[model samples]
Target: MKTRWIWVLLMTASAAQAEEPLGCVEVTVGGYKAPNYDCLSQQMGNNPEGAAAAQKNMEAMNVPVHKRPPNQLGLATPAATSTRMGNTFGTSVKPQRPPN
Candidate 1:
């Protein structure tokens, strides 16, 4: 009975670990080593030094991501412009800017 309980506990522990997100690659960015980029970024974001290091790592890798505003986090559609700036030289009449 005791062996059965131990086996059950071990199985449960293994299952829990298996349920965790996989495919996490070990990365050393900005001299900080972590299991994955997400963890590294989150930890690094806590301090100015870490943030700078993370940014440096990102720049070195040439994969910089711009920080987005909270409101702009979701999928966004661009606002429509009143006039499309078509080729100016293509038109016969030259366009003139109106003074404010």
Candidate 2:
């Protein structure tokens, strides 16, 4: 009975494994495993359409990084000195301290 149970469990496990979806198929050409099914198929020339599709997908996933200018910051300039103290706030109204 124990042996039969073990066999049944093994069969169920195998079935489950077979039913599970696979992400990619790996192939080694020059001692390096191909990253994904598309890549492997591309290298092997098994499916040109599949390879092109995979390449397109990868390119879509990649985003170009915009480079900043050499001098990122803008140059600073000195402000004009106020001829009159009351004109400092850009208003003709006499400058007065707010109620404390």
Candidate 3:
């Protein structure tokens, strides 16, 4: 009986979390997007059609960081090489942050 109750409680909690929608937007789950239009536009410059779709998604996401440039382009080549050799977020990579 105790085990059953525990399972029921866990299930209920999970259900609540799943059902309870959350977001900075006033829509459903993951409904918000980034606020930066130019950032998305810049990123789109590199990706083409895909960038447009991504921009829409980001806009819908409404996240602060997402609003910023994603810099899809590689950062530091050296850093990437170093990472390949080991496990670190070093400066070996040429471009770390998104394109300015």
RMSD of each: 16.0, 17.2, 22.7
Model 2 ranges off by over 4 Å = 25-31, 36-100
- Model 3 / residue 100 / CA error / Å: 46
Candidate 2 residues 6-92, lDDT tens each?
999999999998773444566799998766766455456655597789999998766454443333334222232233333444554
On lDDT, the candidate that comes out on top is: 1
Off by over 4 Å in 1: 22-35, 38-100
Off by over 4 Å in 3: 22-100
What C-alpha lDDT, on a 0 to 100 scale, does residue 98 get in candidate 2? 48
Q: Taking the tens digit of each residue's C-alpha lDDT, what string does model 1 give over 1-100?
A: 9999999999999999877353457878899876767855655555778767888898877642466543354543333121332244335354445658
TM-score order, best first, reads 1, 2, 3
Each model's C-alpha lDDT? 0.61, 0.60, 0.60
Which candidate tops TM-score? 1
TM-score on alpha carbons, each prediction: 0.25, 0.24, 0.22
CA shift of 79, model 2, Å: 57
Residue 6 displacement (Å), model 2: 2.0
